[model samples]
Target: MMLELLSPLPASLNLGLVLLSALTSGLSAAAGIGGGTLLIMAMAQVMPATALIPVHGMVQLGSNGGRAAMTWRHLDRGLLAAFLPGVVLGALVAAWLLVRLPAGVLELCIAAFVLYSCWGPGWPQRLLGRGGTLLAGALTTFLSSLVGATGPLVAAFVKQHFAERLPRVATFAACMTLQHLTKAFVFGVAGFVFRDWFGLMLAMVAAGVVGTWLGLRLLHRLSDQRFDTLFKWMLTLLALRLIWLGVKRLGGA
Candidate 1:
């Protein structure tokens, strides 16, 4: 009932996972990409399918919350306003259908989209208008609810709109935090058994704090262009992996 198949591992293992999540989140945050994508993938290997979204959402909620707080001054209020309504609507829909949706299909679609976005010419730059940003938020939130982590898509959209490096990182972090919080609330409402995962969540949050601090420092030292290039390639690889996993799941199904 508690969703643990084997016994819970030692605290050390949990700590290591949390720290790894934190490091990944921090790097992803610093690079102006969302860390939730990596976090969810890593967690999915351990947590039950039913528990994945809520657990990942809570940890990411904390990770992004911290990053956003650290970069609050650079947030774009107008952009945030335009994005919120769509995100709220998307979150509602995603929560309702999460359990019923064919996850393999959903994940495959997401992976395809992400791959095209990365490889397709000028897609990110072309989708930088107010309308595009709002749509990006809605789509990203919807995909995130079902897939557990698709920060790269949102990051691509935000990166295009915000020319300044710091503003880009800050705004992306803020937007992702909002999306993750919405997801956590939706999962809670849908009865995702949060009470049993408190210890794991706490460990992740603590690691996130440390990782965020280090990432912020590293972000300041890196060149924006270099980070952007690296981020795009990283996203492409992640997308490929998702596609592969989706294919495997579909085969099994």
Candidate 2:
């Protein structure tokens, strides 16, 4: 049954993705960021751009949903409430503007956004609270519909509101869960055939659940100060690779 379910993809690729989902979800669970960014980049290598964003959104919905559930006690309800309206607006706008874009252009866009989020200056303080979160929710979710990952930007913005690690991580996960949920709805309305990819997405999400559990445990054990440098450099490398892939695709075309 399992083999037949995964028949659309080579067994090796299916298994690899399952493991990658676990690792990335765990990374996000522990570090409060990076998992979605890494997972999408890895998927970009094997998946078509047309299918990439929607599939990625569903997988992340499961991953972030799991993290949010695990850390439910730490969620900041006010921030989440502030952010919800913007998510709805973003989803509406994304649905109206949805169009098929070339893979290379999409890849370059994702790479550019990832790079900017990594090194960009902090958002102005005026934009850090309820007002900022509303804007961030709209902008990030809009971009997420196009690109697949905006966790870094969302994380940075969310960070400004909390000092303690658990609250930060929990709230961020909750925010992402809302965003990805909307993304999934938008993609479905836009005519993406999610059923074709359901088996793989389910497997990946299950793995992400395990990773999220392990990651929450690790979060309690590790210090945020230690991951700062490594996190930045790793994202930079991944973004650079996406840039190369984008250029290569454009050149070939």
Candidate 3:
């Protein structure tokens, strides 16, 4: 019984995933935008799609939640206050819909979202506390449930609210932590049976903790300007790759 929970994948692949989780957590912790997307993409290479989304949600909940704790003092309290209710509403909607997106459509949407995050015009940000925050929360979470990682969507909103590196990184961490938690909870209530992947998730999360710590140390040393520039370009390239993948998948289909 104890071993059955972890047998769905070979031991080596499971361990590799655990290591990748740590590395990506560190990446996101330091970079504030790429970790979840990278983590999910890597897992998709070796895991069944059915097991990937919810398990990724659980791992990210741990990773971002850890970063949030470490950066607690830098969090934007007002943003969080407004965003929470919206995510709750979004989670409820997901629970009600429970729809699975076709692979091609999902790839296209994610690619579009990533591109927008990289080069989109700035938001007023002040409006975020108004209906904007609620809408952002609802739409992003809804899309996240379908697509596995909404880091770019969340990062786009977070960027509008912050210019400094630490504050942006910190607040994004909190918002993602909340979003992933909601996603995991929705999956649980929807009968995803997390127990099957629980052991692997725990191992990944434990590794993520170490990665987060190291990432924070690196983040503190980077200049705000340099961080922002790297973030924009890296995400842009990643988005382009996603678009290419989507096009190829569509062509093949």
Best by TM-score: 2
**Which residue ranges in model 3 land beyond 4 Å of their true spot?**
1-7, 100-112, 115-127, 223-253
Selected candidate, larger lDDT, 1 vs 2: 2
Q: Write candidate 3's Cα lDDT for 27-63 as tens digits.
A: 8887777888878766755776567778999999999
Most lDDT-accurate candidate: 2
lDDT of every predicted structure (CA atoms): 0.73, 0.88, 0.80
Error of 1 at 186 (Å): 2.3
The per-residue C-alpha lDDT of model 1 at residue 2 equals 27
Candidate 1 wrong stretches, greater than 4 Å: 1-13, 103-126, 223-253
Ranking by TM-score: 2, 3, 1
lDDT of 1 by residue, 113-184 (tens): 666555764445656677877787788888878776767677767777767878888888888888988976
Using lDDT as the measure, what is the rank order of every candidate, best first? 2, 3, 1
- CA displacement after TM-score superposition, residue 230 of candidate 2 (Å): 3.4
